[model samples]
Target: MQDRMTPAERLAAVLMGQKPDRVPVNPFILGFAAKIVNLPIGDLYADPRKSFRAQLLCAEMYGYDATPMYAYASFGAWEFGGEVGMPYEPGQSAPYIIRHPVESPEDVDKLEVPDPRKAGSIPIAMEIAKLCYENKMPVVFQAGEVLTTAANIAEPARLLRWMIRAPDVVHKLNKKVAEFFIAVAEYFTSTFGADKCMAFTGGPVESNKLINPRQFGEFVFPYMKQIHSKVLGMGVHVILEHPCSDQNANLPYYVQLRKELGWNGKYIWAFGPETPLEKQIECFGEHDIIMGNVDPPSFQFKSFEDVLALCKDNIERGIKNPSGYILGVGCELPPLAPPINVYALMKAAREYGRYQ
Candidate 1:
């Protein structure tokens, strides 16, 4: 699509609270981008060459306003002693966690902050960051956040148990996890620029659905706040990914997080389809960036028409915000998401998402 600004320029303008030609659309296609080129998703991840090319190809195919880097799942865990073993299969878009590093509460104490430069996927991810900078692809990466990384490194059950029975142990582990991601945030901001880098986490982050506000206050808040302060200080933007559903119950905590963090709303917060459109619009629409919320997994079952209709509904709801919005699937697209459905998404975005 022709634009008054380059994709990078449009992203920058919108982020600075200026109008771009239209709202940005960056679905989290990740390894699914490889499928469009018929490469095994495994190689696309492990091999930098394939991963880079596939990411660019997918952006071109979909005409996304910005591209995404897959600093995906377990890269931090593997570096900090988790066993990462899902070899990408032809049909598989992502590797799975064969083994996690920490099995018990005590294991969390043994965790060390790996050197960000030498850590698990940091080298590959660094290479990806370099490529993006050189090519000027406006992009974002998902490194592990403190709370999620704690769960990743240690079993969630064990981590949560410690949060209740032994809160000190949980804090100790979170400190290490926060340190690792803070280094990662610094790396990206230093390599590229703050405007070009976004640090994202929170599929299960302190969601009221998973834990109570008191638990959030006790266990999750401090570490996450530390991580947020450090990363934002390093000049990178931070995104607290889908803080949890049941906004009535959980949204206010997120609201408090933004205000307390003094974001005055520079930070971005994403929400999933499970979150109500009105609530997101009311809470985040005017104050902060909201990237999000089309469901990727449901694409396969729905017809192209249905998917487009849903995208129409989703975009219409999202664009009401003055803070700016990016249309996207909240997380990675399912591996087998149909090409037609993917096309429908891009088409729907362009047709329905144009600015007035």
Candidate 2:
């Protein structure tokens, strides 16, 4: 059972289209890292030094095969001049927007791309990115998808209403959000060199549970096209797209977007649990690296054996992915997830995910 390669080596092999000794367990660990180091979830975001430390410490503790990364669901509010409420309570996992910057249609015209170097969590995130770079790891940046970030800047319900009543305003806001995303990419490219950087994005707002496929085409596709095209143009190594939750109805549009942008193998699609692995592989083909779909809530609520069963099933299919496969949690690991259950993911991978 002894490994033939280190975690870094295994990850590099996959990234380079080479076979590894086994499937790598890249847990989408966030606040869980803080828990490992005995820091409150709030410090995980408010203090870059501590955040970076916690992530590394937790990864070392679990012996996982991925580098530390910084990201949060509520990404845009503070960056675009709104207030954010950092999580300080026991069960709270991520920060939330206390006040959205845009309250009305008029505010959309007032939007401007904030300077990435000094903007909200960018500075804090940059601190972690630099730490990763200095330690010879990929400089990770969470340059979120356009529609989701725009929703954070305004509000989700407001954007939904606007999508029906005032489509023009939604487009205007998305344009500005796209610009901000591009600007952040530019900054990361300049600071860390494009080869050393990795962009992380997620699409929770565009989930079928939130909007239908038509809404995705109308509001999500165009700006996502622009963001992906421009960010890839910056020559970053890869963009990890986490299409979170119930996106089966909108999966084809994602394939279409990739086709339209000519991004054949430029993305790493980490899907949520609601999307089956068979469907994900069918949609993405043998071009992109497929990362995940393990139901994350199980870590907090289920037994270790139950968690192991899920990981085993995911690996059985995911290991056959022609392009590549990474064993990862579907979403961020819940802060309150039992330690033994979290360990089940790695245990299952080691037992059943070994490459022939």
C-alpha local distance difference test of each model: 0.71, 0.87
Cα TM-score of candidate 1: 0.91
How many times do residue backbones clash in model 1? 0
| Per-residue C-alpha lDDT of model 1 across residues 221-287, encoded as one tens digit per residue | 6666776777677666546465534334667766766777786437566666678667877876767
Candidates in order, TM-scores: namely 0.91, 0.98
User: Could you tell me which 10 consecutive residues in candidate 1 have the lowest summed lDDT?
Assistant: 240-249
lDDT of 1: 0.71
**Candidate 2 residue-wise lDDT, 1-356, digit = tens:** 66788888998888888889988888999898988889999999889999999999888888888787778888899999999988997677899899999999998898777999998999999999999999998898887777788889889999989999999999999988888888999999999899999899996898898999999998888888887888788888688999888888889898998788775445788989888888888877567889977998888999999999999999998887787899998988888899998789888888998988
How many residue pairs collide in each prediction?
0, 0
